[model samples]
Target: MKGIQHQLDLAFGENAVTVSRKAIDAGEQNLVLTANTRGAALKVFDGGATETGASKLFGGNLTASVSASVSNTSKAGTDAIHNTLDTNTKLTDLTDVDGNKLGLTAGNVINISGTQNGNAFSASITVKDNSSVSDIMNAMRNLDAFKGATVALDASNGKFVVKGANGQDKDISNLNFNAQKSSTDTTAVASFNKMFGGFTETQKAQDASSDNSLSMQIGANQGQTLAVDINDMGTKALRIQDVDVSTAKGAQSAISVINNAIESVSAERSKLGAYQNRLEHTINNLGTSSENLTASESRIRDVDMAKEMMEFQKNNILSQAAQAMLAQANQQPQGVLQLLR
Candidate 1:
């Protein structure tokens, strides 16, 4: 949404219209684009095509329910998409979806297999007596499969979520977890399926709305434009929107969520800053090119006074020599007539 608004501001003046997200009900999320004044139909010229502000902001043809406020212009999501796992969970002292603690002891090995971003992933995590919930999350995060994904516990429910690091929907599937006894373990361990298998995808992964993304002209030539994809920056997108700070354990779980959100925002800001720098460099290069072109045009069209003066001097000297020779030839003709007389 910020990205959309930025492009709109570049196309139109800043604050010509206001774009915002509103919740009509618990199940749906929508965007609202309102003109500051009546009869101000917000619009923008993207590349060669002219697009209405609503379509550019929401992507594609919008079936908006218009009112005095211009509410529900587009659907962002029904709710933030995420996969949830129990909170304050440790491998050594495992708790299932229910309140029952399992007989999982130290040295129990949990194996995980999943498809992340359309790639197969497998990893085994060893449980230690001192390992906390964070350890498990770290293990998942460290896996190559979850490189562009975030694994963090929810602050409110102590349940963790796995989501796109950039607050976008990710393709992840067949995430299976099961436990076995380690080489040194002798005691009969509780079934890992009851605990780990209960990990549910609470929300479905929804792709970000690309149709709303407008390609802005950033360079002079054709196709020198940028289409900035607007990623969701909501807490639900980060899987930390429902965090609870009322209890100590909840607060502890919330720590990872808060940190993850902070890190995500920081990374996003860095990316935008880098983009700004690239634009600045492009402007400088364009300016330099314009200056060089002007110099070339002057050389082609402008006259050189010094060279013209030198040519004039050379022509005058040659004309003077020719006249002197003509005068001497006339004298020779007169001398020949006097001899004949």
Candidate 2:
């Protein structure tokens, strides 16, 4: 009976050893699954083919918005000037409407005065004895202050119209014309003053504008995004959306627009590249942390094969010794029965 009991104890010990081995196997399997999951996450971050679809963890879309560069346009502040003299009328031959001998002379001067960006400036043109109406117009056009301004002859209505250039609205507003003559020639100075008497308040200038923006998502967390006004890159900002590039003027405008767009795109790209670099560093850090954690888990859950084998040997030897002792005890019981007989 003792021998049988020892055999039953040995059977139970063997069963426990088998259960422990199975538990270790399950732990190793779980570790493998964990490793695989971490690898998949890394792949998603890096962007690659996966079982479900291509990874887009860090992939971002770029949008460029642009507003056209506007040229300021303004009308003249004063009414048109009606020329009383014929186109060929010489400066010395000019007279007032009342047939009075207006002492118009070659030494008469016309001054254009204005403020450009708050800086005061003045330009003058001297009249020659042979100067005609056309010659006077030419001289006005050549003046430094009026060089960029548009001067047109309205022959049908006998009027002169002057318009401020695209970007000279401030200067146009402060524009004033004065006629200077000899102290004794009051009539000539008066007549010259009447020629440009209409100038008063300059027309208001219109500024350029744009409505372009780029909304971007930068991270997985909520509210992790950046919205930038990419106004300088779009068709409207570049002034090409409505421009007709078929004409020389339109083509020149288009060139300017393209250059602006290129600059905008380059700046945006630089910003995005910086974000990419940061994300790459984050990925490297995550990978390192995961590796270290996995190693720690392995140490805790993984079985030491050599040590376990040594334990198994020790248990087996003890079980065998118990069985032998039980056998010896049974034989002694038999000897006791002989003593009883």
Candidate 3:
């Protein structure tokens, strides 16, 4: 017979491809397809900032001092023209009619008389009728009393008036008037101008007083005062304006510096946020890759139980057939023995 049972055993071993059984015996490791990924958790500021190449951290706030002050003072101004007064000045030894010797009281209203040529001239004056002022006023108009002179009221004061025509001095030393002790010596003209100069000097001094106050002091601070001589009247500042650097520039600079600092911080905060986003994306990518790799590995290394079962059934059928063939071959040897019997 073409079939040889023992030869089958010699050629094909008892179990070939038994690796399938070993694989089936080894159970599947993929009960679950678990995937995981992780990257560095996002940090606010650290090595990542350097790696990202961000802007340099800029600091804020600056202040500068400015010290300043100014001063103005009253300097010597133009000298104004002035008038002066003389207190010890008067005509002495003059008189009125009473047969009294010639004399004048402190404010005696005596007639002012000027002697021109050999006759006396009287100055126009206003005084009490009985007073010397009346006597001086009337003599000015009467030719007999004031021979060649006219009188004017001294506009500066109303007490007594004196003037001369042709700007000539009156000769009062030989003054000639009837009211005088003798009329022969009363209206002297050339002597009057000499006496009047003394009185004019005093009037000049009083006018000067009105033009200026000699000295004044102005306040700089509380207790501080500036001494000034006011020849010409005007207003002036004792203390000039000044700047306080500590308060003026410092306060405003502080605000500007603070604002710059705030802006810097805000910019840094924004950079940190960007870094966080990158980290999150990294974590997500790693997680997806790890999941895919795990799934591929599971498929490649898992067991197939249905294919193993089919192979096992075929082996069983082949094994049963081989046993029957082996019995038939041993029976042929038995037939040879039966013939010998």
TM-score to true structure, per model:
0.33, 0.31, 0.23
Give the range of the ten consecutive residues with the poorest summed lDDT in model 3. Answer: 56-65
lDDT of 3 by residue, 264-297 (tens): 5566567657655655665686688789989987
Q: Is candidate 1 or candidate 2 better by TM-score?
A: 1
> Which scores greater on lDDT, model 2 or model 3?
2
Q: Model 2, range 242-311, lDDT digits (tens) per residue? A: 4445666445534544555577678888977876776677678768888999998888656676678889
Alpha carbon lDDT of each predicted model: 0.57, 0.48, 0.32
In angstroms, give how far residue 127 of model 1 lies from its true place.
0.9
Candidate structures ordered by TM-score, highest first: 1, 2, 3
Candidate number with the higher TM-score (1 or 3): 1
Model 2, poorest ten-residue lDDT window? 29-38
Which residue runs of candidate 3 sit more than 4 Å off their true CA positions?
Answer: 1-251, 303-327, 338-341
List model 1 lDDT by residue over 215-281, tens digit each: 5667778767665545677865565545666767556545655776788788888877877887788
C-alpha lDDT of residue 50 in model 3: 20
